[model samples]
Target: MSNSGTPPRRLSTGGQPPIKFLLHYVVEQVPSRNGRTPCFTAWLREELASGQITTWNDEPIRVEDTRPEFAIQVYDTTTPPSQDSGGDVDQRLQALAKALHAETRGEREGPPGRDRDRIDVWGLPLSADLSDEERIATCKAHLLAEIAARDGGETEFPIERIGNSFTFGRALYIIDRPPSRWDEGEGGILELLWDVNPGYRAMMVHEFGEKYETYEYEPIVTRVTRAELGNQWLMMRHGASR
Candidate 1:
């Protein structure tokens, strides 16, 4: 929500210039009022599925860090709606450039201690050329195995195959909602394991689950791949770590 008493900025007296807004999301634990709800993720899923709000791509917008529940579906609204699509094109371009740079090590920093279940995905078409579905399935299996091994028993963690796109000679993937237990250290090991041994990429998730929580210990895979990693790196580098 916007700050109180902060009047909406208008581009004109009676009309406004075309403007776009950035939506920021974060997970916050709220105190339940009475016997009101389950976890935050469960409550959010109900809100999104209720059809009370429009999504971006006719896909459900969610907050869960687990499968299906976190799978995003977008929808568009005409009234009080989003800005024109033109602006998003440039934004997407900038994002892609940043992603490429970070992947190549030009930008090598990321956030720390965010030991929550999060997801990071990297696409190097030449690495394995695996289809998005194959990647998700392979990764999910790997993660499940890791969870089982760590907990010392059988486990079933939610996993959802999000969506994919082809760009810059690579196939891009977005995992729906990653298991809430994933951390940066685990993400790094997974990336490295996949990068070094082509056949073992499928099991990298498990490797990470067995070790560190933030540092990237391998050259093949690093910690800068997580979506939230960049921002964290910036914050700490600038002495603004939160």
Candidate 2:
């Protein structure tokens, strides 16, 4: 946060209007004292710089919001973002995901995709016992290997997560190869489904809003090649008579 930008204006006490403070979570126009605003601003910057304001566990500050010089009426207020607001959707989503992932709230906007059309790709099993951190690490590993096995493994190529959404709950990785077989009239699809669950609440966080899809069926699957299978296979023989 460089001070190269426009300086924050001093607020008024009696006659002047409230100055707008545009925080990422909420927006507000607040009135400040004639003198203490400078002190408060400096203190806030210091607190942020010292890794105090951002952390999950922080001690309460001694500063008071109530006073003749510093007082606010409303508990909460918000305003719509105007054009040329310079707001960042990615930053807001990251901040909200960091906060909301730990909470048990919010609603899903809709299904992940049109019934059975999307979210069909799969990979390794994500154990329910694993934490979110563990699951993400596992996903990164699986995706890395999958890409390395394909032409996309090149370092210069663009690689991204299947879907950049904040998801939680018990889920497993099922590579989409088997479903392609199922659609192709292959008989082995049932073997892959033995360990698979009935369904999962596939929740996701997006820039627009939160959404979820009842995940069950997928269309595509990774198909193993005959050459790869033959090299590892051994022919069996037996002698019936001496």
Candidate 3:
């Protein structure tokens, strides 16, 4: 431990930057409280098509017309343990979460009452666990469901897992690839990247430089009900107990 004169070895060559991204959505309209907002699932599809971002996993993302507005903030850099120890991994995970949270909305720049309500009232909670291949299958299922729902019936979207958390928004999906593992400093692994309805797309662009060279999409505006949002929240809090 006394050999302090030597510099530490580098983990990645490009001097990877920390996760940078943001999340935004339309909270309320001028005159309409009868659930005139859009669905989150629909926005997912729009994001993939837009090509402003990229995914670590090439999974299918479908947008349902019935889902609410929700978005995610993705980052491009993958930070690693400075010392390659267990604790380092934890730190990396925490960093990712902090980035994600910052992208979503931090203490100062966060959305106000109406905007926050949109995420809380319109969005649906998407939670799942699986491997890379399994995750792909899950995404396909979600895409199909979203498409079906858009035509008429209800549908669901897929869950995407990167380094630490899963993602579920148009702009957010592309910002950063999901982490394969976790950092020790964060104190917890990002088991999931949960997305609710009434997605977040604008915020990600504002925070993370738009990966327009990769993908971009617009927010999908559809009708989302409070009951549906409640169900989504329940699913998020209890992990599909609803």
Candidate 4:
């Protein structure tokens, strides 16, 4: 997408105060052909150009527009007269730098280790043995149960059937809720992709936090490929059926 308005102003580190850098990205849709028909591919790009600081402490910090694709060293402290004297300042600067890095990189701070094993969505292994119809039924049932278990009950889960994709051999479902009802830092919605032929299931929960906005979901199963189902549908419709 084309940028509008003035480019952001560059950050100044002259004050020696800890800097908080905020990077914003615009989601753009670029036209491409999946086969014969034209489709739009969505991607994130830096929204501003001039706001980026190219060099800090004589070290090059690359910023493509506003995207933080490079490492940033934000801490600059000279040797203290005594080791213990500057300990507090060093620690504080380190923490601030870490936080800023996480924000710019759009990192999600969550519990370590994989959450996939805990995702027994349908109480059945989404194995290749199960039929497509059976998988779909199980997924729907699981979604219903999840909705009922939430705070707002079934009303909270506005399940939308996104239909089948013959190309990828999967059926999609979206559990959407209003932004108001969604708790801060909590995933507001769930998306399920059930492979029709292989019977493999992948699920993602959309999450948001104070510092960053991410389009990617927190996956229940790690190996499942992230996809834009809408784009996939367009591809399938345009004679790219798998």
Q: How accurate locally, in lDDT, is each candidate?
A: 0.27, 0.23, 0.28, 0.30
Candidate 4: C-alpha lDDT:
0.30
Which portions of model 2 miss their true places by more than 4 Å? 1-118, 152-242
- The candidate scoring highest on lDDT is 4
User: TM-score: which candidate is best?
Assistant: 4
lDDT of 4 by residue, 146-192 (tens): 33444353331132222232323433332222234333343322334
lDDT of 2 by residue, 147-231 (tens): 4454334332222221212121112222223223423533212111111221222222222233434333432222223222111
Q: Select the stronger candidate by TM-score from 2 and 4.
A: 4
Pairs that collide in candidate 4 are: 167-242
The better candidate by TM-score, 3 or 4, is 4
Expressed as tens digits, the lDDT of each residue in 56-165 for candidate 3 is: 23643222223233323222222322435655543443444333332333331222311221121111122333343343334334434443444543323222221112
Reference-based lDDT, residue 157, model 1? 28
lDDT of 3 at 231: 35
Report the error of model 3 at residue 134, Å: 2.2
Question: How many steric overlaps does candidate 1 have?
Answer: 14
- Report the candidate with higher lDDT, 1 versus 2: 1
Per-model TM values vs. the true structure: 0.20, 0.17, 0.21, 0.24
Candidate RMSDs in Å, in order, are: 20.2, 25.5, 22.2, 22.2
